[model samples]
Target chain A: MEFLLLTEKCIWFGLGAAGFAVLFNVPPKTLIYIAFMGAMGGFLKAILMHFDETNVIISTLCGATLIGFLSIYFAHKTHCPPPVLAIPACIPMIPGKFAYKMMIGLVNLSGNIDHDTYTQIMSETVNNGLKVVFILMSIAGGVGIPLLITRKESSKGMRLRKRS
Target chain B: MIAPSPKNKEIKDLGNVLLNVGAMLLSSGASTGRTRNTISRISDSFGYSSDLLISHRTIMLTISDKKNDYFFNNLKRSAPHGVNFKLLSGISRLSWQVVEEGLSVNQINVQLSRLAALKHYPRWFTLLFVGLAGVSFCRLSDGDALDMVTVFTATVCGLFIRQEVHKMKFNPYICIFCGAFTASLIAGGGLKYGMGFIHEQALATSVLFLIPGVPLINSFSDMIDGNLNNAIVRGLNGFIISFAIGMGLLTSMLIYRF
Candidate 1:
């Protein structure tokens, strides 16, 4: 059951990414490439969290960086912009739960300014809200670093090689 | 007005085509750096020196044939935001072909029109996949099987409404706001009626499809590439979409609470 759960989430993540690829209108040829990237990133994050050794930010950074590296390779092979692959692949890491909780907490706090229950909710809200921002920033930065180094040069070189 | 020379007329026409292509790229959510480079490369292939000034909403392009002393300038606004990687790739390929293959202006125009004419996936197909994606997100977030099924159904219904609203030409914010509201309402209602195992996960993942992943990433890319204006603009746009989504989700919760 444990092993099955591990693989199951990854498969679902990949399928989810394929759905996003279609939504984004990526060419069919590269859909599998993107799904693989998404699966790897999503799986790696889940594994790290399972270990409980690192927090959400670290795990997300690792996963997003993996997506970035693979995006570079796949973008080259497929001749599409790296963003086209990286964006959808990274969507699975967006921390939707935190964002939703933050909003709910805010609504409760607004309705009851001084209640003890509201105070606890407010603290949880702040924690979750901060996690959402930090995790998102980590993912963006993790992917952006690789893209900055390779994306412009590889495309330029490809153009030059074609010209020659 | 002085009668324009033939070379001036030719440059003007090419300028217009370049403007159209640039606007299409920007509107399609191409990063500012990519849009600028592609436009410049395309103009270079046509033997014109060009400068492109891109912001979040507008592109200002000037094409000059310095040897013949011809200059043409045009400003165009970006179209609505949508992501079509095939279109981006097609335009990228077209730019390279123009540069290396020495395609003529008329041939480039033909290819551009063909690429532009490409359509997104069929509406039903998109709706189905978006629903599946929502279900997948629910699972990834550790939602139980029941929650996944609930999210899947809600997402499909919500996205269908979004597609229809878009067809009717509503503002994008309004469309997303309504879509999120509908999706969350379904999920929230389902949980209220004891349809899902996890209420939070169902409500959370149902709106995953509306997350604006591309723009959020592109804003970071734009900032790193030193296109601050475009970066700020894209960032604000992403933030607004997020606000719309939050508003939509809250609206459903509020109704559910009552």
Candidate 2:
């Protein structure tokens, strides 16, 4: 049963990645490669959360970093730019729940400024807001490092590497 | 060393073509590195070296041959941002082939026209997949079957409205705002009526379709790649889009009192 649930999560993550890829108009050939990377990243996060009992932030950072590394590899293999593959793959892990909660908390505060409810909502809002920032930053660092490293010195050594 | 032969016209035309190609790639949201490399490679194939200055909204190109007579043009325009991998890869391949196969400028022109005319997938196709992607996120978050269906339908409707508004050439921020509003409104309505067991999950996942993943990712890579100017541009673009989405979500929550 545990294995089944994990499989299901991985599958859903892959499907979601495919949907975004289509919207981004990714070339049909590399769609599966990106989907697989997205799925693996997402599954790794789930495994960390459920099996290893890690925090969401660390888990997501690891997953996004993995996606970042794979995106670079695929970019080289397929001769497409890394962003063309990495960006959509990272979409499935965006912290939408936290952002939505942050919005809700702000809206509630505006409505009831003097209540204890307001205080609780404020804390929740701050927490979620911070989570959103950290998650995004982690994803950025995770994905950016690989591309930044690979991009340097490439113009001189591998002029035709990506044009094939 | 100015050669006053008929080849002067050919050189000018070649310069024009190179400028056009650079402009198209820039407008297509290709990063500065890729755009510069592709332009320089194509011009080199024709025995003319080129220089480029690219920003988020403009491209400047100067093409010169052995005689050092320079032809230059600058384009000022804001490019609509959307990622199209096929076009990026196709143009890259074409530019490389220009060097490998020694294709003439006229031949390159024909290929450029073809690349520009490449067909995008239909609106309905993007809508279906974008919606499905939202639903899949819901599933990944452990939303129940009913919640998944709710998210799926809400996202599909939202993206349909977004595509229609985009077709009308509405500003992109407004399009994203409207899309988020419609999707959240449906999800909120479903929650109030007791249709889905997970209110927060559905509301959160339903609007995942508008998360601006591409711009955010691009902004990060741009900064790390040390294109700080372009990185700032892309980061600002991502910020405004996020603000628009927040407005849409908040408006829906206020209306529904959730």
Candidate 3:
């Protein structure tokens, strides 16, 4: 069951990413490559997180950095920009449940409530909201690594390279 | 009447080309740095120095010729931001062509039109696959077979509503609000009624396709690149959209008490 869960994580995340790519109108040929990258990143995160010792933020950062670097190679093969491939593939890593919980806490806290209840709700909201923020930052920070190093599009220097 | 000199006309033309490219890139999802770089590359290739002021929805460009001592300024209001990777990639390539070929302004304009006219993947394809994405998201959250069906149903309905509302020229926020409301209505109902063991997971992931993931990442990337103003504007935009989606979900939850 544990192994199955890990493997399915990869497949489902890949499908999710491919769906996202379609929504963004990525060219048809690139979808497979984007799915492959998404799967690899999702699997890496799943494995790291399953160990139960590593922090979620660290695991997410590693997954996203892997996606970021992979995007360069995949983007080269697909003939698209790196972000075009990387961003959508990273979407599955978003903190959806945390965001949902924070919103709910906010809504409940706004109504008339006792002091203890208010404190409890506030704590929950802060915890969930902070998680969402850090996870988002990690995703951005991790994926940004490749983008920073690449500087210019891979296609930019292809002609110059051939000439030289 | 003295005719304007050819050099003067050329500088004006260059300014127009720069505005068009900047507007297209900014609106079509290029980051601030890329848009600035592409504009500078094109202008430099044309022997003009360029400077740009890029805001949330407008680009102000200045072009100057050093020896001729000519400076021209142009401003254009960019279209609303949307995720279209094809346009982003297309314009990047076009920028390279401008530099490599020394293409005339008219030729670049022709190429821009061609790229703009390029068709997206079929609408039904996006709609169906987006729902599949929702299903995949549901599964990732540990949803079961029954929950997958529930999410698929909710997502297709939600996305269809969004597209329909968007096509009618409704504000994009309103479109997202409506989509979120529809998806959560169905998923919330499933959660309330216990449609499956994983129905809660379905409910959570159902409206997630509406999250502005691109804008969020773009904002972070912009901040890292030191475009602080653009970053703040984009970050705020992402937050507001998330809040709107949350409000829609809240409304559903209130109705269903889930």
Best by TM-score: 1
TM-score of 2: 0.91
TM-score of each: 0.95, 0.91, 0.94
Candidate 1 structure quality by residue, lDDT tens digits, A25-139: 9888988998999999989988998888549899999999999999999987987878888888888788888888888778877884767787788789999999999998888
Who wins the lDDT comparison?
3
Candidate with the greatest DockQ versus the true structure: 1
Q: Residue B97 in model 2: shift from native, Å?
A: 1.7
Output the better candidate (1/2) by lDDT: 1
Q: Pairs clashing in candidate 2?
A: none
Candidates sorted by lDDT, best first: 3, 1, 2
> Which model is ahead, 1 or 2, in terms of TM-score?
1
Candidate 2: regions farther than 4 A off: A51-54, A115-117, A152-164, B1-7, B76-79, B195-198
Q: Which candidate model has the greater TM-score, 1 or 3?
A: 1
Candidate 2, what DockQ? Answer: 0.66
Model 2, B1-258: lDDT tens digits are 876666677777887787777777766657777777888888887788787777886777777777876554545454676667667777887886887778988898899899878887787888888888998988876688788888989999998888789999999999999999999899888887865475678888888898877677777777766788988998899899999988988889889777
Supply every candidate's count of residue pairs whose N, Cα or C atoms clash at under 3 angstroms: 0, 0, 0
For model 1, which pairs clash? none
Model 2 B-chain TM: 0.92
Q: Which of the two candidates, 1 or 2, achieves a greater DockQ against the reference?
A: 1
For model 1 the local lDDT of residue B172 reads 95
Q: Under CAPRI classification, how is model 1 graded?
A: medium
